[model samples]
Target: MIPTVVWGTGNVGRAAIRAVDAHPKLQLAAVLVHQPAKVGRDAGELAGLDRSLGVSATDDVGAVLAAGHRAVVYAASGDVRPDEALADVVRAVRAGAVVVSPALYPLYDHRNAPAEFRDPVRAAVEEGGGSLFASGVDPGWGNDVLPLLVSGLGSVVDGIRCQEIFDYSTYEQEESVRYLVGMGQPMDYVPPMLIESVPTMVWGGQVRMMARALGVELDGIRETLERRPLESTVRTRTMGEFAAGTQGAVRFEVQGIVGGEPRIVIEHVTRIHPSCAPDWPVPPDGSGAHRVIVEGRPRIEVTVEASDEGENRSAGGNATAVGRLVGAIDWLVEAEPGLYDALDVPLRPAVGRLGRNQKEEERA
Candidate 1:
């Protein structure tokens, strides 16, 4: 079994613990934390597992890295702390621990990634003789892998579109929703996520990744946005009441225009309240789903609706991300040491993974 350490204990981090613990190929080495409150806690308890794994959580990242784990699942958020997260991941790789993380967005497709952000990570991999992989649920599989795979099913394809339609009220990340995404904020204020060329900076890589997967050269990337305000006061279980007329929902599209048209596109329809975008596309279950639509000869459309513990779609989606990264540990360890993304490494299915999700299994 590969010795694996999970960093962070938040949404994705907790899921990482569960994934690494359950995987037959991985051993729960240690969990790294940033909060003092989480230190010295049992890994299973922190991950909400059925029993303790006897591995304690520590905030000392250096000691954990120095302990010689084969792989590190870096779940720390890069939304607000990209630089810090980059440095941390580099330190892990330099310590000779193969890294798989969603924190570093720039390395999602390192080949076309900006030199400013990609060079440091590239250098770290070269010096450490370790590998790095960056991905997430949306920008990860929902964008690149799923689109290209769906396109193969159709005989002729004119355009490919990926959509993330969900309600953010259940997702309790206040800073991300309120500030980064501009949810529940005033319309006059421009959210940092949508500022000119920022969407392109974050999601444009996914567009390029998809284009490269489909073997097409894009003309250029483009962005179009729309905002809607809540008509009446609404309340959420996690977040408190949102006043009427504030920013209630946001819909945006980052298109990879080819041949003078938006051929390859990534669209997000997010609403603080489900009713905000009644007319916009939504999950048939009224929760959320990753959709891939191939507009062509077959006009194929596929939607994935998944959930984790007790119908927590947010947790379920993140679990899939954890599963994707953790499942690739052995593959990343044996492969040539370099930076990788979804296209570079295949997500191999674990033989015992099915038994772990037996409840969801029987439902099928």
Candidate 2:
């Protein structure tokens, strides 16, 4: 079994712990949490699992690395501290641990990443003979793998669009939702994520990755954004009140232009309240969905909605993200040391997990 450590206990980290525990080929090593209160706690309890896994949580990064774990699931939040997160990943890679994460955005497409972020990771891989892969839901398989897979069903694909439609009311990140996304803020307040070129900086990699897969060269990339104000005062369970005329919803697209036409696009329609954008696309079943539309002779649209920890779409999305990263650990352990993108990893079936449900049935 591959010895693996989950770093962080937030949204994604919680799912990673449960995933590692359930994986047939992996063994949970030590969980790393920044909060001192979480130290010495059982990994399962930290993950909200009923049973204990015997492994304890620690804040000692040095000791965890020195213990020589085979793989690391770096689930720490990078939205607020991207530089520090990158440094942490570098430290793990240089300690001879193959790492997978969704923290660093620039490195999502390492091939086109800036030299400052790309050079150090390359050097670390060489130094310790380890590998690193960074990916997530929107910028991850939702755009790259899912769309490309659906495109194959079409005889002649003219254009492809990947979309993430969600309501952020249940999303736990308050600062990101209120400030970074401009939700619950005034209409004139510009969210950091929607500023010029910022969308390109984050989701641009998905566009490029799709173009590369389709064997097309993009003439250029472009961004377009739209924000909507709440019609009336709205209150959320966690976040407080969003007064009338405040920013309640946002829609944006990062398009990859090919042959002077926008051939590939990654679009997002996010809202603070479900009622904010009635006309915009929404999940088929619930408040969140990742969708792919292949505009061709026989147009195909696919939607994925996952709910975990009490039907919370945000937690569900994070769980899927953890699934993607943790599932790739075994492959990274066998592959050569280097940096990799979503395309480099193969999506395998749940061969071993198929029987897990049956075993649980017997146990119960």
Candidate 2 lowest-lDDT run of ten: 355-364
Off by over 4 Å in 2: 357-364
Question: Which is the leading candidate under TM-score?
Answer: 2
Query: Residue 229's C-alpha lDDT in candidate 1?
Result: 96
Query: Which residue segments of model 1 deviate by more than 4 Å?
Result: 356-364
Give candidate 2's TM-score.
0.96
lDDT of each: 0.86, 0.90
Worst 10 residues of 1 by lDDT: 355-364
lDDT of 1 by residue, 107-168 (tens): 78789888877888778888888789898656378888878988999899999999988888
Question: In candidate 1, residue 125 scores what lDDT?
Answer: 81
Q: List the residue pairs that clash in candidate 2.
A: none
Give Cα distance to truth, residue 25, candidate 1, Å.
Answer: 0.3
Q: By TM-score, how accurate is candidate 1? A: 0.96
- TM per candidate comes to 0.96, 0.96
lDDT of 1: 0.86
lDDT of 1 at 140: 72
